[model samples]
Target: MNNLKREFDASTVAMMRQAMNEVVADRRFLICQSVTPLEVAEHILEQAASGERDLDRLKISVFEKLSDAA
Candidate 1:
């Protein structure tokens, strides 16, 4: 039982470390862009929440806005 607990703990720690690495990598990408990382992340979350992640939908929306502006 103690051994199993240790294994689980080790697995959890490794998973957390990998997740941290991914976040750091994402931060690096975010830093290169014009928008802040937090804003980008929030937009991603909002898109997921709204189920509006389709690329075609985003493209059409942008095009519509541009046409309306013209």
Candidate 2:
């Protein structure tokens, strides 16, 4: 049970890291260094929490959030 939980946690972290990298690699996002990578990661996590696993949707949502912030 403990091993399963650990595995799940590790996978979740890896998924988030991949998502964050995708967000950072986006051309629109790259032009906005003021937003910070961590902030974009948080946005991605937030969308994931809401059951949004679609990568394109996550990217669009993150971009919308950044635009609103700007």
Candidate 3:
């Protein structure tokens, strides 16, 4: 999420924010606590950078990546 960052238009940013929030909520639900690991956000940002625009797909990809990492 460092140098990979690039400017996105307002709507894209909003979608990413919505996806991030949903991802966080889903993660919390899975573990039953208010915990959001930095890697989760980082991974989602990376996925967004990689041209993933769909909110649901972005979230599922994050969970899939996290599960693979675990």
Candidate 4:
């Protein structure tokens, strides 16, 4: 239903936002301004979709991605 779809969308957005905040607050990510927090957030969401929901793991995954980029 449309309502179910809307709810899913809302939850996804909330998750992404929370991930973004966590990434931004991380000391490892605080010094980097080249990549947008949104990009990192998307990466986190992708990892979560792939069944990795643990915050620490997500943070490490994002950190590694950014490290590789740099």
Best by TM-score: 3
**Which lDDT tens digits does candidate 3 get at residues 1-70?**
6785487778878988897778766744367333356777777778878888888898788777766655
TM match of model 4 to true structure: 0.65
Q: Candidate 4 on 1-70: residue-level lDDT in tens? A: 1122222356656766676788888877877766677788668767766666566677788888778776
Quote the lDDT for 59 in model 4: 74
- Estimate, for each residue in 34-57, the C-alpha lDDT of model 2 and write its tens digit: 798888876777666666666667
What's model 4's overall lDDT?
A: 0.70
Clashes of 1: 0
Task: Rank candidates, lDDT, best first.
Answer: 3, 2, 4, 1
**Between 1 and 3, whose lDDT is larger?**
3
Q: Is candidate 3 or candidate 4 better by TM-score?
A: 3
Report, for every candidate in turn, its global Cα lDDT versus the true structure. 0.40, 0.70, 0.73, 0.70
CA error at residue 42 for candidate 3, angstroms: 1.3
Residue lDDT tens for model 1, 1-70: 1122222245444543443344436534434444443543444334334445454453344333334434
Residue 9 miss distance in model 2 (angstroms): 7.5
- What is the TM-score (0 to 1) of candidate 1? 0.30
**Clash pairs (backbone) in predicted model 1:** none
Better-scoring candidate (TM-score), 1 or 2: 2
